[model samples]
Target chain A: MTSTSTAAVHALAALPQPYLLFLGDTTEAGFAKTAIGLHDWAPEVCVAEWSLPGCPISTGLPTMTPAQARAAGARAMVIGVANGGGVISATWLPALVEALEQGLDLVSGMHQQLGDIPELAAAAERSGRQLINVRVPPRGIPVGNGRKRSGKRVLTVGTDCALGKKYTALALARGLRGIGVDADFRASGQTGILIAGSGIPMDAVVADFSAGAAELLSPDAAEDHWDVIEGQGSLFHPAYAGVSLGLLHGSQPDVFVVCHQPGRQHVLGYPDYPLPSIEDVIDLTVRLGRRTNPAIRCVGVSLNTHGMTEQDAQAACAEISARLGLPTADPMRQDGRFNRLLEACIA
Target chain B: MTSTSTAAVHALAALPQPYLLFLGDTTEAGFAKTAIGLHDWAPEVCVAEWSLPGCPISTGLPTMTPAQARAAGARAMVIGVANGGGVISATWLPALVEALEQGLDLVSGMHQQLGDIPELAAAAERSGRQLINVRVPPRGIPVGNGRKRSGKRVLTVGTDCALGKKYTALALARGLRGIGVDADFRASGQTGILIAGSGIPMDAVVADFSAGAAELLSPDAAEDHWDVIEGQGSLFHPAYAGVSLGLLHGSQPDVFVVCHQPGRQHVLGYPDYPLPSIEDVIDLTVRLGRRTNPAIRCVGVSLNTHGMTEQDAQAACAEISARLGLPTADPMRQDGRFNRLLEACIA
Candidate 1:
């Protein structure tokens, strides 16, 4: 089952009393739709649209005076500020803080982009509110019909900032969807998915690292602290090239396709900073499959057209595959070699 | 002479009409001292103490209403807001705008690091006030008069988020000051600095890259545009790495010492992802130096402790130096190897 389907099933079984409040402006139509769609399973779900006097959609709700909004009782609040630069005004902070004090299960400060409003975020944190970020997908990605299904397992990639990562992720998602897979993309980071759902708490680990955990721990201590690993470095850092290997360990996968863009090609190594080749990818896959369940299958690679042309991207994929001895294909092409590789892996 | 001294001398020689305003909870004594310092140079230099309401210091000067503060001004205005989560309020935006509309020469938004207040900054920008950030150094950097430098060198790192960059720049300035270089960091983009005292009308370059610039340029052209470059990546992404490199290049520093905690080592390769090693650093330095100016001199490196022990730090420094064929010395030690390397470079 797809993650979204699984989530829906779980929601139906539990009958969650999901209460979402749309604070500030009304730019987050996608989130509203998502919440409203779940209303059938969560009959008790309440979505209050709160706004100031001049705000467009000020009806069917109490005036967005902080006190009135606090009294409305929302388990989760998604605050979407108007586009441009109004989100960071001092006038918007008090109301935000008041909502946090009233107690909220989850509070997402939904701005088109967070880099534009650091003060608002800092204020939300000071008020003891965990801010969740919901980002729009990139322009190139075809927004799939929400009601359609393709019976293929989906993989999602998320990052903290919305604009750039969203573009790459949406493109990747669309590519996957084009190949008969249903991919659900979301923003993930301190102010997004990690903050919203029940995942490994990276913040606590970060706090432990900041509080001198490295020095205090004995050499023989079990590596229960995931923060140390994250802090030491990730696949993105040469200091932690081994991190990707570590993260992939003990995982069962039929096929592994790494997605990246030319601008960010260095992450997986390219040109001068080359790591193992396509052969390494196949070798790792086979080794991992044997180590885990022996049912593990194939390896494929996809390149993001972040700032590269189709020709350059295809060339890069070929080079990567040739070096590693793994199967290679163009992700953007519907019936391209990439889809063939994926089919081979799953078959 | 120090950069600030050079700047002060240049300012005095040019005799620009200095309209200065001090914000924050600064004491009457502190205000008096600052006022006296500037009074010696320009008789028209105005000092408004926003810390106290109705203080004679702010009496007749055009008072900025909250609404005006939020509007964008053509000229720059300095501000000092109370740190510690102090709200500047949306109401204050108009007054800032009014100040800009009044044909002020410059606006410096000074504030204590009370806490994170992004709204105040947005209001200042909306008013078109040039927001220059100022802050006290961090704890590890020795403050007060034991050091020769009174304030740090104000190097404007990035302009997208002045307050955030200010926080990091201030920390960096303090780190530099601790090592006896009187650094006063400023948070202005290259455009801001070019127009700071130039009196030239600013024209923002917003090219249609894919249409206009992309056809004639290389693949990196899309990544070079500030908007696209800024939008695409995280502080840890490779695209951002170019931005940081650009910032470093614009600063034209004698030496660039990147300060990073061991935990956040991901930032070392940051903006490009997969942090480059000592050899990569050497290569990058050579590439940047050759591209910018053949006469540019290369200097040794320094590492911020970030709470790492002296032994571990020494080992890391040594490893880095051995890889780069550069000498490694203790940054903290009075007679350390790094100190000697810095001394030679400065000489």
Candidate 2:
């Protein structure tokens, strides 16, 4: 047994890959982002998609059940839909149990353990298959010591949770390397961890060590090297500001990009709490962030403009850039949209 | 085993008592704050103190070994010393094992587990005494929903960890009740939990659920009733700011008291990281706090002037009160000093 004083970061990297993605009955594309993310970022390891009948969402991967996917070289079935509060639905149990029985290890990012369900546990035990909870942080993560590290970091913070922080950071890292800069994408959540083959599941870590874990996520490196760290919950997100604050302080980003969903009004799941403005996010990020990183600055703004017209998305980005005096881009735009942001970050 | 999605708050309240306090071999009084706090606040439960040879600290209770304490009717031995970062010393293990062997249940607030050590676990098992870890939060705590509860809450925030957050909250709650006010002291750490007979172990909570657990701590009280919540960790502290921010947002305190140690230059564990100014702390607390409670305001300052001369402490309080335009008082001062602070909280 390991010392309880330390925590281990067991990543999805060790899970037998070539995965069959379980999308549950989620019809919304947003709920299927994890499966889509894997298809987009780690396509080679994603064998196919599995969803219940009537589920209209798709990652464009071939539809296959657990038995078919396992026969097609899939060794683990990943629960790709992030049900709200990470609570597993009982209806999703049959597919999960089937995956285990079919000789595919059942993996989940849910806070509610997949093995805790009697049927799933029984199936796994009988089949000798594994049940992995990526959201359960391993023991013994030390408390963060607010020491300045040598390497530079850029974190993608947001006005709320899940608005493109992961996508923006992924794009920025890829874009940085494209421009001959030394950069690495640092994932902070389940989907990102699965995509990157490694990362700290920030939301699952013990609260006291959030910063410490972040410190470990992007350790000391060449002064010129950049760790493009993906951010989690927003500074104004009432339910998650604490997690956001800890990540902010721990990441100590030399540069930050604010991620926002233009039409999103209230914090996700918290209808009573309205989302903070981008300006407010920037102001508070700098105000509290100065405790750990006095030189931290916002290099750009990243908007998730998936539902908007091209003209409207461009207008929003242009208007925000003028108002906030920072470069703005929709990370999905493949043109030179991030050039200004890249320049500012490297500067 | 419990559902992993939710967390439980098991307080030190049920530990078999009147107790024997274990002081370890700590030389500093600050390190012995737990033992002293129990002796000071929960005197009825604390019958004696135990420390190894050469330990200079004292809780002013009669010294007793575990055997002697058990003979004197003590049913539990409490680890009352907060060793830096709660790392237990190997030298203290023998005394702990002795306590378990001498017909006493062993309890610890340290992040390190007593049962994890073979000697103590064997002793407890052989003797049929329990090994209780108040630091281990129970299963099935939901994520914070950021819901507004019906209650007037006051939180004692800090400039760093291990100052006066717990004591100040205790005093304010006691003083509020003395003035015919409906109030309760809500503990957030182990010693505070022991003192109050219940609390959420903020440090042990999963990072994502810190705020959610805290919401459960204060709960919904009468609109006029006050939940004087004990704070943990400073927002400026490197190792524990996440815990602090989570508690702050969860408590949603309408009024907060800033607690500081007059001469503390650095964060408790990290000497390289300096403690934040009271002004800086107040600014950030209110700024971040506004997200949870729009009318959040600072009511007063709680200073730990234990190492200061009476004249120095008085002068410091006067200077700070005038500078910040907030009432200031040393919690140890019983000259009706907290009256002004209490009035401001209710105001």
In terms of docking quality, how is candidate 2 classified?
A: medium
For candidate 2, what is the total of clashing residue pairs? 13
User: Model 1, B1-347: lDDT tens per residue?
Assistant: 11112222112022223444434334454443333333322235443323335344432345443224223322234443333443344444554444545544233322232123454344444544333322211111110111111111122222122112322333334444556664333323222222122110001101001111111111111211111011111112211222232233223333333222233434332232233343444444444423222334434444444467778877877775676556554444434665555444434
TM-score of each: 0.33, 0.85
Q: Which residues of candidate 1, in runs, are more than 4 Å off?
A: A1-182, A185-299, A302-322, A331-336, A343-347, B1-19, B24-77, B84-255, B260-298, B301-347
Put down candidate 2 lDDT per residue, A1-347, tens digits, no spaces: 11111123344235578899989999799877778888998899999999999999989999998889988999989888976777888888888888888999877767677666778777877888877766666555667878899989999999998789999999999889999999988888878877775678898788888999888888899999999999999888776777888899999999899999999998988899888899988888987787789999888899999989999999999999999899999989855667888888898
Model 1: reference contacts kept, as a fraction: 0.00
Global Cα lDDT for candidate 2: 0.84
Q: In model 2 chain B, where is the ten-residue run with the lowest total lDDT?
A: B1-10
Which candidate wins on TM-score? 2
Judge candidate 1 at residue A245 and give its lDDT: 22
TM-score of chain B of 2: 0.84
